[model samples]
Target: MKIIAAKKILKANDQLAEENRAGFNAAGVYCVNVVGSPGAGKTTLLEALFTALKDRLRPAVIEGDIAGSIDAARIEKLGVPVVQINTQGACHLDANMIAAAAADFDLAAIDLLVIENIGNLVCTAGFDLGEHLRIVVLSTAEGDDKAAKYPAIFQGSQALFITKADLLPHLNFNAERITADFKRLAPQSEILQVAAIQGDGIPPAADWLAGKCAATLR
Candidate 1:
């Protein structure tokens, strides 16, 4: 019975995701769904990325958390449009939730819309939120074996961001091991090392996002 209920939920989600995709296609907005574990610096990376590209891209953020407005508050301070979705206890953000919140934004005016999913490595992987791209963040403090242990999230993502590189010297995290594990799970996904707090290794990410945005326009 549990399996059946889950499938029904996912089916409904996929249908709404298609509807959301149509809306994005009509508005010509590039949307990215960013997922990661709790306290993995998802908000920090987004704040830095948005600050770097805000002038050029007209970016907006949709923050998904279980019950707090913390991430939303951070993005709102950046002088951009932001919507906070408190799942009320849901571990992930589904398509219906995103579509409903999206109505609050002026999608046509926005060049990029980023949906920061509830910080969970497992459940978020199964739901499609109608994003143009899926970016997964893994922090060095979270251990390097995450890709192997949680293959579905890594495999399903288009890009993988290894955050907190500044702490590499003190942690047991091995960059090579993470790379190798990602190679096995998601060979084609671009992997970038980022230190979101110190503002290191972000230009490349911004450039990559810019390229994707331009491609979408073309």
Candidate 2:
């Protein structure tokens, strides 16, 4: 039945994910899988984060979208290596897609490989891309109940970034409530509130990423 078929698919994905992890280790690169909903500012955040971490780490991006290369174009304008993976109709990017896209880059020259997953919360959580870390982004405009409604993504992530902090004054977002919910679901994960567009909270985020990358690379 459907359950049996789904298990087979996931099993295949996990096997390839392990292979991808080995490749990352051999290349000495730290990879992060970034997931969020559309308009969650995933690309905008990366645009700024790349600038902040550029001098410290050679970072590259693998931009995934249901279609179009708009996000890839933005990253390329930053003078960094970027690969675009158009899933065509797929909801999430799988390990095989990552392996193919990653092969296009000279991984040895990169210190960080950030795969910006298709703007989504549900499917991406279950599919492992063999990333060293997983980050879930929630925009203040998206409301605070996301953690309660979609615990899988929130629970599985190593970090939660509540983006668009600049809008907090205007929106009736319950910051305290979201914080409590996130802590309950993912007590060990770090939560960072950042206005990625203006770079208000990017430095600390950059520092955290740099430290994680350094430790793994060493």
The list of candidate 1 runs beyond 4 A from truth reads 1-9
Clashing pairs in 2: none
- Angstrom error of the Cα, residue 179, model 1: value is 1.0
Global Cα RMSD, each model: 3.1, 2.7
Candidate 2 regions with alpha-carbon error over 4 angstroms: 1-9
- Taking all chains together, each candidate's TM-score versus the true structure is 0.94, 0.95
* Top candidate (lDDT): 2
Measured on C-alpha atoms, candidate 2 has an lDDT of: 0.93
lDDT of each: 0.91, 0.93
Error of 2 at 137 (Å): 0.7
